[model samples]
Target chain A: MAREKFQTLTEQMFYILLALQEERCGADVMALVAQITQNRVAIGPGTLYNLLEDFLAAGMIVQTKTEGRRRSYTLTQQGRDRLLMEKQRLERMLSDYRHMTAGTEKNQRDTAG
Target chain B: MKRKFEFNLYAPFQYQDLQDHLEKMAGRGWELEKAGYRLFTYRAAPPATVRYAMAFRPEVGWMDQLPTQGQEIYADYCRDAGWELAATWSRFPQVQFYRSRKQYPVPLETDLTSRWRVTAQWMETRFVDPLRGDVAIGCFFAIFLAIVLTIFLAQEEFAPPLFAMCAAADVLMILLVLNQLVVLVDAQRWLQQAKRAAEEGSPGPGGRMSLPWKLTTGLLIAAGAATLAVYVTNATADFGFLAPVRIAGAVLVFYITLFAAFRFRDLLRKRGGSPHWKWIVFTLVATLLALLSVELWDWFTDF
Candidate 1:
């Protein structure tokens, strides 16, 4: 099934928004994503270019400044809200993991005891 | 500087092979100068290792010329990332060719989903739909030819020359159908593989030089040669030795007119001319030229 546009953020999209929490250029966003993820997540230049365009169109990111071809952007309120929503969704998943595994461990301990 | 021309029929989905081929040429001291319909021109340059990247801008349409305002901005983005605009196919300006000497950790398009979506669009627009249309037309032609041949046989009016000509046409149509089918299958397979890769967040299954595409091109050439051979061989006394010559002349005239039309469009685009009315002008001029040529040929033959 086709996904609704930007309903849920991919890892790259989430990190891109996280990077734009501070006013950063497109290249800076790419660099920051890789750095903050310890090289685990890297955004290609073409992908970064496209995501920035999409973000601008969606009103999730506002262009802070333009230096010739290089443009800087920071997250809008909507973008920030979306980022927070994604974080909460991920935390919920982690909590579910802990709860489910906690029951399994408790059962094993009870049986052993 | 020395120059070389080569036939390049690789579809947009096979961009990996296209990029690698260009890079290899660059390593051999040749740089791509132009890309046209199934043709690439390379110019001798200093030997260097270059990485070629392909990207598509969906907004760019068929009629738009190179480096439209939007495309210029897109190129600027690539420039900032160390990629230089190398060349673009005049017919499809959406497919941008970028080259860089600076090494990057990843390819131009890193996101598998984005790459898949772009490539899928190209595959649909550029290859699959077009080939499907071609195959459908070929089928219709084959059916029409079969009906005509059956009627001729039933009426006992089929001449040896006509039969041979029909046979030649059937062979050509069959070859065309096969060629289109081969490419269509290859495109569908690649699209499926790409979709799976995108889902897995893995590197795309980049297409290589497909043997099927090479065979398709070869079959097309063979079909043309066979058709010409049939025309030459079946030049009977009633058909006249000049029949083949007349057909060749007509073919040449039409081919020249079509070539002129494309060249005019390309020239107009290069001059920043509007594409809105170019098609209208091209059709009128090409039809007039073709009709005039046919009339002239008739008058000359009578004279």
Candidate 2:
């Protein structure tokens, strides 16, 4: 099977898409992402703005409402599917690492015994 | 006591240098009050530490009162992230935002690809578009000059010295235009290099105008002005009434062309339509104005 176009997501993109799971304004997304990442991953305004525009253009997100100067957006179904796929890919990597390490440790214990 | 002000020039592609320079100025108690094309004004203030970041937005025009929707949204996010919009220069398509170093500073652009896109857009709008326009104008002027020179040379009673002076001035004007084109091309090259570096997540080299090119351009302008003065004085003595009328007509055309250019730009920006039709309308209006001005001058002189 051919590889997916967006099979791998950058850390910033992943967090941004995750933050958009709930309908939030641009500022709200920044604050929520900061909170969720425990201040470890900080998305800059320029990066977030461009990413949102790209996402909106790609149909990954849809703007829900605009009040005054602020705009709020929510993830579309495609966006949610992409996020889920990325999460599953990350989980598979983690499990593979665990299995490899466990096998190496067990071999060491058998040799010692 | 009034604060002191200083003017400094920065190229559009010198974002890092401008940022560092602004930060250094803040350390020495100077704050940026306004920014313009090649000119930055700073006001004296108490010494403090501040970090500056520049973001490029090409969609915002110079005369726009309210920020565009995208700009407003971006500003809101930046403000919440602790960056304040300090100054915006439409000529350069950049917004300078700042925050105190004491506060946790958030990077304005975390990703390299987005940074490259911003810079690329600025280059295209500010440098590439203007260069294309300038080149077209330069070519038209060159052809007009050639035709006029040829006709002057063919005339039996032409003043050789005056004609030579006028020709020299015209040549200088062409040189100045060409020099400008060269500088713009250099700037575009620097921007392309910067974009490539951004793709690789590295800082690119700063853009600067060549010293020799600047000096030559200045010299050509001065020489052109001097020759024009000499030519006008000689022509007035020789052709009397006709010289003044011609000179007035030329001046009127020049000013009206400039006014038309600005009006067309504003119209296109505000209306957001096909530029081809807009340009044709602009040219037609400008030509009519020139003809009307020449007729008015003839009538006023007759009276």
Candidate 3:
């Protein structure tokens, strides 16, 4: 939802990039999405794999090395910085929401009194 | 082996319409390979069901072998089927479903991607021969027109030497037209080879206007000009030192203009300029300018 800039990168780009940041391989990335979204969201090899291709193109994550038909992607400085920035913005939003909701709760208690 | 025929249909025809037509003739058995971009390469058709194909050309390329010649059969058929015949290259009027032993169907690929464009690079070439010859003819025509117009405006002033100049221009025109036709025939043959070459993935027209062709045409013009010069010199007043040199310089310039045009043709081709049309226009403008320059020189020197 916070991705206001990456219009062409699409919905799957963020999820795939986030998965890569966790030191996950392709299969692991697919499994992680299933576990995190409780299998409600599914990404196909053809489509999801293409997003991973975008990361490869964007130079965010590169195939650090290959091991037995398995290629691993590692974050470049750009990717890590981008992910950390997203996390910080999300955390700030969460804190703002928490304080606002607590004030709303206190106001409700006073009205009941 | 009764040489098997294959149909390579490349077009961007209406899909639903094509699908319905293909479905109607589904029972007609032929090993089919339905590649994307509305391409369906067909093998020999069975005797039972008639072979049918319908597809549209992608923006990049097109092929239709089955053009019904002036009989209006194919046009009528396409009209009925809601198919509009795509524009074919005017130079090759024989566009439509051409019969080929399935092995020999015409290939359709992007012209820009072809090897003719990719591989044809000129390095340190001083003159464009085959190409310049064409341009020279174009310049000759323009100069002829200028000469004719200058004479006409001067109002029937056919001086003793004017007749020779006019005759020379006439001879040059005849030679140019004849040579253009001869080269045009070769161009047609080369175009046929190009169609085949592109099919083979060469991605080029696969030929060049040769040295002999270029040399002969240039010589033909030079010979005609030299003969004219001889006659003009004999008829005109006895010349000073500059007259012979001027005549020599004129011949040299004419030949070299053509050479430069041909040598640079490949470079010009890379830049997407038409050698045929560009040379023609160049010839026209250069000849006009040359004639004008001569007139200017005459005026200045007289003053």
Candidate 4:
């Protein structure tokens, strides 16, 4: 599961999506993501708002409500599809690669010899 | 200490929107140092800033001109509760003088028809982009997105290609415009600066923008005409030829919009048509007739 997740995730992109998947608001998403990241990434309001603003403009996310002078966001059908596609690609690669390498170094040497 | 700007109102304003004007004041190197009720101080920046200040605000009038008694009262009321009035004079009402006389700012170009002749001229001339760097950057980004869209019609990778590109472009443009707008809020700052500059007088302020700007405008107009002539003669439409067309268009549009808006709004407030309009119209008609005759001759002679 970890390998599959790691294979598909873009560090910033994944965290943003993960944050939004739960909170359902823009400010909340930013806040939750900041906490989870331990403040390593301090995105300014413009940058964060810009990204979410872009997402909403593109219809990748829908704004649910206003939270204390901030808006909330959740993934739309398109965004969900995109996230799932990335996950499936990673999952497929993991299962297939493991099967092919199942014999390991010992099996390869004996079989070749 | 560096030279600073100061605003002096010979007459008072009623709904004086200083921030909006000042934000429009700075260009290139000049920036706001301090702003108050009716005085704005710009810290003399590098030479470029001064030049930019000269170029940008040159003489952008407030609401096109000074306010009348009725409008003045209305604007004063519009002022924040704590704001104070600076100086007022009724004799030279609507007459604002730059503290320092750097040659008068070049009047902006005033043509906006998207004609091929104009585009050719724009390409021929060197145009200093009126927009600031950040604004230019945002514009470039929009162009970049367009380029990307041209290459990638649509695939989920960039998904809804046109829509996504357009969305990003629009949002970025808004952000860019807003960023500039916030700075524009310095009207009070600029007015203060301009007023102070007026009071202190221009540093080496003997220079004037009018002469140079006028010549440049004339040159641009001539270049546009020449370009149009050349294109008509050559009968080809290419990048090399069309570059000047854009500048010419920009200059023409910028000046026309600035002056028209200024004059029209001012007329409405002053309740008197600007005397300058008569001269301008006369000059414009004469020039047009000359051009038309020349064109008619060329058609007959094919030169």
Best by lDDT: 1
Q: What shift in Å separates residue B47 of candidate 3 from its native position after superposition? A: 28
lDDT of each: 0.76, 0.72, 0.46, 0.41
Q: C-alpha displacement of A38 in model 3, angstroms?
A: 1.2
Q: Report, for all candidates in order, the number of backbone clashes.
A: 0, 0, 27, 52
- Model 2 off-target regions past 4 Å? A1-7, A65-67, A92-113, B1-8, B37-39, B61-64, B90-104, B139-178, B194-303
- Model 2, B103-188: lDDT tens digits are 45888888766667677777777667777788778767876785676667567345677667766766676676666666676676
lDDT of 1 at A68: 73
Candidate 1 residue spans exceeding 4 A from truth = A34-40, A64-70, A90-113, B102-105, B125-135, B146-165, B188-216, B232-256, B270-275, B282-303
Better of 1 and 2 by lDDT: 1
What DockQ, on C-alphas, does every prediction get?
0.39, 0.43, 0.01, 0.01
Q: Under CAPRI classification, how is model 2 graded?
A: acceptable
Off by over 4 Å in 3: A1-11, A67-70, A105-113, B1-33, B36-303
TM-score of model number 4? 0.27
Best model per TM-score:
1
lDDT of 1 at B45: 92
Worst 10 residues of 2 chain A by lDDT: A1-10
Per residue, candidate 1 scores C-alpha lDDT tens digits across B115-175 of: 6766666666766767678777876787677567666656767577777776667667666
Q: Write candidate 3's Cα lDDT for B1-303 as tens digits.
A: 122233322111122243334433334544333322223444444533323332211111112222222213333323323333333221112222211123322122112223221122110011123445665678577567756756664676676565556656655655665565555455545445544443443444423445545665876669586666755475345556556556555556654554454334323323443346756665665676567656644543331
Could you arrange the candidates by DockQ from highest to lowest? 2, 1, 3, 4
TM-score of each candidate's B chain against the true B chain: 0.77, 0.61, 0.33, 0.24
What is the number of residue pairs that collide in model 1?
0
Query: Quick one: best DockQ, which candidate?
Result: 2
List where candidate 4 sits over 4 angstroms from the true fold. A1-10, A40-44, A90-113, B1-303
lDDT of 4: 0.41
